[model samples]
Target: MDFYQADPTLENYWRGVILFGRNVASYKFALAHALYEVDKSGSDLVTLEELAVPFSRHLCQHLLHAPKQITSRGSQFLDTCVQFNNGELTQDTLTETTIRLGFNNVIDAFHNVNAGEIEKRFFLDERKTHKGIRITDNFYQLSERQQYQNLAFETNARWNLVEQAWAMGVSRNLVAIEFDEQEKLLFSHVNTRRVNITSCRDSLNGYQKGRCFYCFKPISLVPADTELADVDHFIPWKARDEVANINGVWNLVLSCQCCNRGKAGKSSHLPSRKLLQRLHIRNEYFIQSKLPLHETIVNQTGTQPAQRIDFLESNWARAKNNILFHIWEPKAEGEATF
Candidate 1:
């Protein structure tokens, strides 16, 4: 479904889905970023080599699911990315290898953009014809438009959503696993007994005082069985594959069914800075409990309380900077005015 279809909001349109359909002319954030970030040389064209690097990097960072690679290739690629970021490897060298993994998919994705059914008049490929893959001047121009930017944002939001689901699955090593039919081993020995999302009602709700994280509404736990508090990841666990221990107590919080469902649909929102602050206090409450969760907090951050605060703050900042993740605007959701 289209991002707008799922969440009819200005922010949803601004941060679009990975829409690529036959003659649908839909928008894609990856394509827009790749086009705009590429060389602005006199000609409206750049070689696949030029575009390939940025495309690979962008996809790697923004990829929602495991890129569907052979055994260990995905983790290998991630390790290389870390090395590259840490200056152990050069960008050019990393790009050379990484392009092979997803460049072809990028080409097909661009094809989807051109052939999709959103604004045919703004189709990127219509402006130019070239033997090799190259972005056109029209693409650059279109990407700058307000409508284009909104769609781009929507596309990114979808990508973020997929990435979140992917992380949740991967943290449990459930990637590519088929439970009903054939069992596809993604990580290693599948533990049929150990569940990643264990029952957190007893712990999380008690810690939260049975209040929803987002709405702060009182949640029912007993025979009421209505609006039960859900143990939700405070940080959303979108990039758990990249960041370890996201499933830890430090990131766990309670949300009522309504707020939980609302947040579940909001693929593009980060809790505001103030909410992050609140989460810190909440986690600090956990530390005072002196339970296993207390150790979790100490281990994730440090022995020093100030360091723990710094850890939470820096992590939220990291999230904001890393994905350009924005705070949710409940007011922004509605019929598309543009």
Candidate 2:
């Protein structure tokens, strides 16, 4: 489904931008975090300097832990952020640099995803008329959402995952990030040590676009939500002995608790061919996003689309023959919406 057509809600539109949008640099996520921080003041109109404070601060904070924020070889704006983080540059200098170079493309490109603009505009670019952006009613309503904090954490998680991917490089040996199902994180093995990358739930939720993988209902990473999201193995993980790369990102998905473990949960059963096809579509989003998971999926599955499909089907056939005796289907489902 067209991402915006799936749920048209403000929350989904925000997720579409964060999850599916292109990521040549981490500026968009930093800008998104800055928006949330600024929104707390309840100001509809924000000057470039006011927005620059949080925006530069966020990029600086993240840079301290993970150095690579952009996919390119270097960025002058990011270099300025690093200097601020290192105490080599003053906060005033950082703010001025942010205003001059930070908003160059993100301000205009924030709402775009899947080569289209989302239906809702969270902020209006008043920079041409004024010196800043005007927060739209859509943004205020989004700020008031019950899942607002979850959105903030999701952006951080996506940023962390992308940078980690860039730092780890695309080699199979260095970039083999494994999921710790118990801790619900994706971690990589560096030399002899293991480094946890980011929350698996927060990272995958974007590709799923905040909806259940099976029934297509809204889901959340927030601890307080009654119907919390679950990190699920699309093909049952229990049959690992029969399937290669069973725990690969290509096989994992974020599912609603009900569709994951409730009365209609797939449990150890194999999903129907229809759901397998749905899984294929979801995995393609990972490929299209060109994030770290894109390389991981390609290495585990195949380099081409047809080969990836064959990989899933071959494993499904093997698991069907070995472990699962039942074909599980969701009790309730809507049109496929990934």
Candidate 3:
């Protein structure tokens, strides 16, 4: 079935794959023990090529269906496996070899069960745009230009201030906005203004509408709850300082705490040629015309206008796919077995 059309139960299966993949280090040690036994019996070398299938099946069955809590050792082994198989882990030690083998097993297993086919199913219809344009293009075009850069920077700075103000409210404390000698706000004071924490949470919640843009998890904020969901910079803030980078609403997204944490400060979005092509944001004129107004509506209302979501989702999905493929290369490396 197409990944998007997969039953929720089947969806959970993929989640299990990701979670298991992340913890492949633990599986590596176990596989190592098995390999040692096989080798000790005067058998041939049990490389990844020899053991991929059974090991993958073993992991899928034991790791996913079993109810036992994963031990720390197991977690480490699985993590190592994923890193090694994806070539992110170096082969300086026996542990690394085992981990790489375990990862190979997982990839083999995923293929055996047609996991890749499922993912392709969901992404099959994802559209492609221009190859030259991207988040940086939009940011530079908007910021370097005479008309909009200052406005963009000022707007982002303002939001930074607003975010701090909202944080104070969550802490149930008063705070003051700190300003430089020139009267420009630098930071917020401790325990000064009675921040409208509810309003701030409401604003972010409304923007996300409860769904994490990346993981698709629901992200709701309870009234008076201190832990607010994070607002992610679709393109990280550190990448540039232009007004377009600061003010573009298309650059913001609602993310669950976990996915947001994973994506923090990551600038390289994807490595695959096809995926990169999809992420390129060509048509500078379109970006210039649309991004500033999108920012204005978001800043004023703390929510995106509906019309913008359609365009933004398409653009964001391409960018997100690029990042996911880069970071989760193991998930993308193997071919579908079926």
Candidate 4:
């Protein structure tokens, strides 16, 4: 769609990574959560405080969706934040109380000063002169919060920032350009599992009868050295997540080493229609077992099986909208003839 040539502020403002309404992803959910940090006193202008809210949240909570957290950016940051706290909560696996203690440091990372702006790193350098400006804009040549302006809506004839954050949609081609290499790594790592991917090996193997998720190749339930049962994020973790845990069992699947290697980090990839159907059936099996995962799916979507299917279909709508006819896997490698 030549996203590079399109207007950054207006053209695709309504299209980026939206999380809540229909095609919402966790990344978009992070952005929406940030909009709530704004001050509501009369003025519609955004402040540095508001801008930092989303950045901090993304930096701290991105991997919360994943099954394990040992290697996540938020995990590392949280550990650093609490290295000094002396208590029983630090016994192993931090308690929620320990996590809450670091809340102050997270917010403090975004300084409250005109001199240094940390939030600007995630925004486009280019400015939109027409629609005011965001406090996060450059101190020298400033840009508008135009990227987020479109998300705004009037309540009692006044624009509400929080509401806009919730309703703002995302572009199919949206990319995070502001974060540099080290920071990028902090926000993302596909090989990064929330917990050991192997933890799901037994559960998924039993569910699929020891067949790979995409290829349906026979996998050894007890492969020596765990080579045959490579845990895969059904939706590649690299595609949309900015270093959060995309390793949830809902997204995780057992795959043959070949298929997992071929599908390496293709973030934009979506499963083919056939695979999507397979996934639906597999999930139904999980539900029938009445396991904890079934409850997890319901908690995630707040709906029954019928609505859950609808959500996945809708998520794929944007996922498949890439310029390449099929950015999904098997574009180069031959898919299994299931």
The top-ranked prediction according to TM-score is: 2
**Quality of model 2 by C-alpha lDDT:** 0.83
Ranked by lDDT, top first: 2, 1, 4, 3
Q: How much lDDT does each candidate structure score?
A: 0.48, 0.83, 0.34, 0.39
Measured with C-alpha atoms, the lDDT of residue 327 in candidate 1 is 71
lDDT of 3 by residue, 1-338 (tens): 22213323322232222222222123432332233233233322244434444444344333342322133334544454445555675545324344344454333343112233333111111112321111222222323433221222222222333334333442344333222212212333444543221122233332222345444455555433333456555544543332233223334444556555654422334223332222122111112222222233344223433444444444445554543434321122122211
Give the C-alpha lDDT of model 4: 0.39
Which order, best to worst by TM-score? 2, 1, 4, 3
Q: What is candidate 2's lDDT per residue for 1-338, written digit by digit as tens?
A: 35557557788789878877888888999999989888556678888989999998898898999898887898899999988887899999999999999999999999888777878999999998889999988988888876576798789888887888777775444367679989989887777888898888888877776678888777888877786788988888788899877778888988888888877687778888888898888888777766677877887888999999999999999889887558888865555664
For model 3, what is the C-alpha lDDT against the true structure?
A: 0.34
Let me know the TM-score candidate 3 reaches against the reference structure. 0.25
Q: How does each model score on TM-score?
A: 0.38, 0.88, 0.25, 0.36
Which tens-of-lDDT digit does each residue in 1-338 have in candidate 1?
23234434332222222322221111134555666565555455565556657665665564324342222234555556556656789888777665444344435444332245333222233223552354544455655643342333334433442333344444344222111112211121234542221134433443443356665565654434666556666665675554456665577666666655764433435777767777777677545533234444676767787898888877777776786766752222223221
Once superposed on the true structure, which residue ranges of model 3 sit more than 4 Å away at CA?
A: 1-201, 223-227, 263-338
Which candidate leads in lDDT?
2
Model 3 per-residue lDDT at 123:
12
Better of 2 and 4 by TM-score: 2
